[model samples]
Target: MRIFTGVILLTLSTTSAFADCGTLNAPTDQQLSSKAYQLQYRMEPDGLAVSQDFSVLFEVCKSDGTAVEGTPSVDAYMPMHGHGMNYRAQVEKLGDGKFRATGFMFHMPGKWQFKFDINEPQGSEQLTADHMVK
Candidate 1:
């Protein structure tokens, strides 16, 4: 069973957007009926540096189940073991509640953490999700 640890943006219905990650625990049904987000990823070693490519798709409500519309500038940060992850996020919004963040490179890997920071006209929010990639 995959365990997901993060805030829920699933039940949101705003012109707002999201910067979330995916996992096995992600709802099999894309029809988000809650207040949460999910992501899927693939990590490859780029020479000596490891690059993390991922996408965070969130189903958020604007006001009481009114599907939100608007682009939420999304970004992902991969933190190193000793220091917080440096900002290497390459994020872009692809309309339709779909946003992508890539090129989150980590030169080394050991108990690393993942954080996504999303910016909207409303404001900005941060979420931290940790995982170890061997």
Candidate 2:
């Protein structure tokens, strides 16, 4: 009987820990994931425009849905052209795993890759999402 009670308590504690990690409020435009993390992002002002500056709002969460700690960085690059954006994006933390990156421009792009670099104490990882501009 004592062993059964201990097992029940252990199970409850583990379940509650994961329950605290909730999913993102709404669906995002794009999502990228690795073995340990998941990133959900959406471009500000809805759609992409050529040669126009915009912002990207994103959030990084652990595989268990818990918000990740540490600051992350964002960047854009054109693999085919071998060049990146003229301006560098400024990243801001909005708490609870949320972040916003501003000053992004696609400047005559065909295929652009949005890079999200997650730098945490555990390790560092890069996740990329592809977008096409008309």
Candidate 3:
């Protein structure tokens, strides 16, 4: 019926809208390396936005370039602005050194430093990446 057809169209449009956001994973985008581990991360929706909920997907690897098992904690702040994000991102371990952080929202756009504190049997290390949000 017409209602069914309309629903189908609405579903398609919603799917396409998400698709247009693009995949945030890019090897060359943002990365950090330390004596403990190396981290590569990307922000969902391609670029960072102001006052919008976003997700950060990251892969953590050992110094020897192997996936690690650890606990990840996420935090963000603007050093220049002397303030941090109003929202706190929660980290979920996805196994194989992969994690997904959700509930992140930058109240305003600027140079916000994203940091991941990872803890493992060996010890803990902090990795940070600075992003310029418009």
**Top candidate by lDDT:** 2
Candidate 2, backbone clash total: 0
Q: 1 or 3, which is superior by lDDT?
A: 3
Per-residue C-alpha lDDT of model 1 across residues 1-134, encoded as one tens digit per residue: 12322223332322144323222234343323323332332332222234454444443333332323554443333444356445555655654444555555554565655554444465555445555555
Worst 10 residues of 1 by lDDT: 1-10
RMSD of 3: 14.8
Indicate the TM-score of model 3.
0.75
Candidate 3 Cα errors over 4 Å, as ranges: 1-25
- In order, the Cα lDDT scores of the candidates are 0.42, 0.82, 0.77
- The parts of candidate 2 lying over 4 Å away from their true place are 1-29
Rank ordering of all candidates by TM-score, starting from the highest:
2, 3, 1
lDDT of 2 at 23: 45
Candidate 3 local lDDT, 1-134, one digit each (tens)? 99999999976865454333323355565867665566778878667888878998888777654577766898998999898888778888887677899989998878999978888888988888888888
lDDT (10s digit) by residue, model 2, range 34-113: 76787878888778989887999888887666788987999999999999999999999999988889999888859999
Measured on C-alpha atoms, candidate 3 has an lDDT of 0.77
Better of 1 and 2 by TM-score: 2
List the candidates' TM-scores in order.
Answer: 0.46, 0.80, 0.75
